[model samples]
Target: MSASVTSTPVDHAPRVPAAPDTAITAVADMARRARVAGRVLGHAGAEQRNAALCHAATALRDARAELLAANARDVAAFSGAASFRDRLILDEARIEAMARGLEDVAKLPDPLGRVLAEWTRPNGLKIRRVATPVGVIGMIYESRPNVGADAAALCIKSGNAVILRGGSDSINSARVIHAAMQAGLRAAGLPVDAVQIPPDTDRRHVADMLAASGLIDLLIPRGGKSLVERVCREARVPVLSHAEGLCHTYVHAAADLEMARRIVLNAKMRRTGICGATETLLIDNAIAPVLLPGLVEDLATEGCTFRADARARAIVPDLPPATEQDFATEWLDAVMSIAVVDGVDDALAHIVRYGSSHTEAIITEDEAVATRFLNETDSAVVMWNASTQFCDGGEFGFGAEIGIATGRFHARGPVGLEQLTTFRYEVFGNGQVRP
Candidate 1:
């Protein structure tokens, strides 16, 4: 799940102080509206849906000043760590990126109404599995306001309506963003309820959303470990877990020194707050004496702190000794844990022990070793000579992602247009009766 700097979200919307039952009723009513909207969106033509996305993009761009103002308020209200604040603050470039994200989603191939597979039955009947929307998606996220826009746009393009619950600190920004999305829907002649947020960011509303079993088709939690765990444990509806990103970057014995240095720096420091940032570094013992110093120096120069295992500490004696708990932690900041392994197998074993099964990368020139790492590493995304940060929906050419699922079933990795859809069988038969 996404991490938040603040525990209590600032309320931007006016509150009525409703009873528990009232909150439940309100959530159900909103979900029912979303379900209705989802049906309309799901059956709409691809062109119409794309039009809505383009309008949304336009709306986002036009509302740039308003968004920036709202985001500034959110940032001011947030009393969190600097890294998380970085995630919350939005600038012109980030807003433009979000707008472009919607446009990019509009340009992608329509995921609906396509034939995923076709087969002929022995009885001369034609059967095809056709793509369809998952109906209504419940997106529970934190800090990043862009998540709400990205989720709304992706859900709209894939023909699903979304109910967003952004973190408390981001309530002001979320409201402005949600309004822009609705405006786009209205301009495109689509139901405005297709993209909705609750009246307030009450913690109780989360439970209400969780209990909306029949109303919500799927619940996707995109926050910290606690948030994901709670959703997966309590949600009555089907859930896709966007678990922690305890990612790793391994430097193999055959790794290019220059390449390893560059990849390691980018993977850990490019954007330290994101889920794809490398939290752990595993280096081969064979190359540690020669490669470890330079790598450590590079990361330290970028203000990165280290927690080192005995083997790693042996190479860099001044490094803080890493406890087992440190290896398991997702710092989500500039802190990283280092382990010196014997070889690829050792690296793999360490990863298996500590990784979140999210993303991992190997820095090596040997094709055989790269292939082995790629094939053997049990992660949603495995890269060779590249940064783990590349495990993003946009980089994968999906425009933007709803979230990166760590779960095994249904959707895994970056959830995009295609991942947002499930398929239904369409069978054609004529004059067929029981023999």
Candidate 2:
């Protein structure tokens, strides 16, 4: 006999106020509209979608000054912490980059309806595995207003609908970008709901989107640890959570001192605010005394602050002391933690203990060591003789990305256009049935 579990009456009681009912209903309705839009987008040819992207790019480029003015209003209104300000500020370069990104995505090969695999069975049956969009994607992100345009363009190009929830600090900027997206969609004869931004900036709307499991196909949280943790905990839907990127760069004993120095300096100081920037530096003890000072001094000269452990401090006595929290922190600023380990094994252990599994790099001429590090480190991107900052989608030739996915399943590493798609099997059988 089989047993079935049933919910009691108390379990079916009236819904408690997890979030406001009105906001929840609005998000739900928007999701429904997006889902319908996604169906239309799914069947639309690549030419049509590409045309939309081209129009969007043109619109953004032509209205750069207007967009900047709107972004300035949002920046002026922000009374939040410096961290929020850091993420929200938009300049002419970023807007131009956003427009160029849309143009790049428009030129790339369309991912929808591509045949992944095809096979024939013994019974003369044919099976085709075709790639399809993931339907409606709910993006809950912080600060960066550019993410609004990037996410919408990527989703539309891949034949999926996007519901963007940007931080309140960039609401005005997001609204302006969203208006451009709508114009693009309308120009291509697609529904404006294909890309929708939240009408309100209330945090409760985020809670509502998180809890809307059935309506939202996938939830992608892009921000700090607290936001990702909250979304992971509260979301009833499948979440592609992007946690803090505690990236690391290991300098092997056999590494070229010059190469290691260059790699370390670029990895930590190239752009501290990006997720792929190295937050920690691990040096083999054999090379620390010989190569440590130069690397530290080089980074310090470039305006990077270091928090060193006991072993690392022994090499540079004047360096600031690193706490247990420092190893665990993802200082998305001009800050990094340094440690001296014995060898590859020790380095691996340290990374497993502290890494967010986002990206890790090793500087070594030894093929065996490089192969081992690449194979062992369970990060989304494992590089050898290169900086961790190379872990970007644009750098990887994907044009642009929604963001890097630190999670294991679905999309790992850079979340590009191809990663945004899911596959389905289409089997063609000639009179085949189960016995």
Candidate 3:
């Protein structure tokens, strides 16, 4: 999808600050530096860019322990509730994963300068759409320090500059990762400003990034609903915004009970704090009696908590009552909501009304049912007989992602290296005239 203006701006609304003005100004200056660097990067050879990514991979691997140590400081200093603590904590495995992501990005083909499409007219006019970097990107995210590395690596690989504004809770970790990325850039004889983490941890800087529409080509907010909503409402710049992941998994009557059971358990409990985790399980009424009981019991054994509708509660009397909010919530925890729909139509209707249009799945043996679900679901990623967690970019073999965009304009699914690029028309003409 291409970017374009949709409407006129209105009154200013209250926005969540990303940092203090002093810090915001420093970051803006850093971003300006990166923009200059990006001009060089945009023309840099693919081999040089790959070399930088290779260096980043090595730096990340060598600094793994130091990175983890820095992350530990952030985790220890976290004063928020349990949920915040969960988001703040990072371990050796997560750090290693970040390094691996950088290495994988290094392996992918460079997206910059590649010719996407071309055409020639009868009047001897020719046009080619070539991929180009999207310029400086301001990523405002929360808690997850690993995102800093991921965003930096993806932007660098795609030949775009990046400015990261991570949550205050993860300042230390973000700093360490950002330093490693700069080291990689310098090692490849590239400008260190190519990847920057703002010195300010105050919340107002997010506003500055958003308001600097001419400077930041895109503002990607990669956190919860409130953060994304704030960016969408306040940012004058274009936003590839993604809100909640109130994802769903529908178990149709034709579904294999065992497969449905396993998929549901994995989808909901494998990792609950991610956007792709299934928050609601929609079971066909025909299969609800036969499959619901076992599914609920299976999930319970895995330490999962559930809020069930009347039908589900009847089947599993010990289940907690499901509320309206439960159906609409993206419980990024060990909690899930259950409802029994009449059939495929009801399931589709329910998802259309309540889903966040992030990821949705259907478990069915009938090809027609599965096909319908896939075709009808209006989400960035849709699946049949697969877990919602598969919506991730890494799983889709893109190395890493900026974030999963649920919008229709620029990108819909995983915003990976390819998604980070915008196409420009390259035209060639031999004495062609408009007349």
Q: Which is the leading candidate under lDDT?
A: 1
lDDT winner between 1 and 3, please give it.
Answer: 1
- The total of clashing pairs for model 3 equals 9
Residue by residue across 285-390, what tens digits does model 2's lDDT show?
Answer: 9989989999888988988888999998898899999998999999998888999999999999999999999999999999999999999999999999999999
Tell how far residue 431 is off in model 3, in angstroms. 2.1
lDDT of 3: 0.84
lDDT of 3 at 38: 81
Best candidate (score: TM-score):
1
lDDT of 3 by residue, 240-328 (tens): 96898999999999999999999999999888889999999999999898898899889889888999899888888999998898899
Candidate 3 displacement at residue 39 in angstroms: 0.7
Report the lDDT tens digits of candidate 1 across residue range 117-188: 999988988999999999999999989999999999999999998999999999999988888788777767
- TM per candidate comes to 0.94, 0.93, 0.93
lDDT of each: 0.89, 0.86, 0.84
Model 1 local distance difference test score: 0.89
RMSD (Å) of each candidate, 1 decimal: 5.6, 9.1, 7.8
Cα error, candidate 2, residue 197 (Å): 0.8
Backbone clashes, each candidate: 6, 0, 9
Output candidate 3 Cα RMSD.
7.8
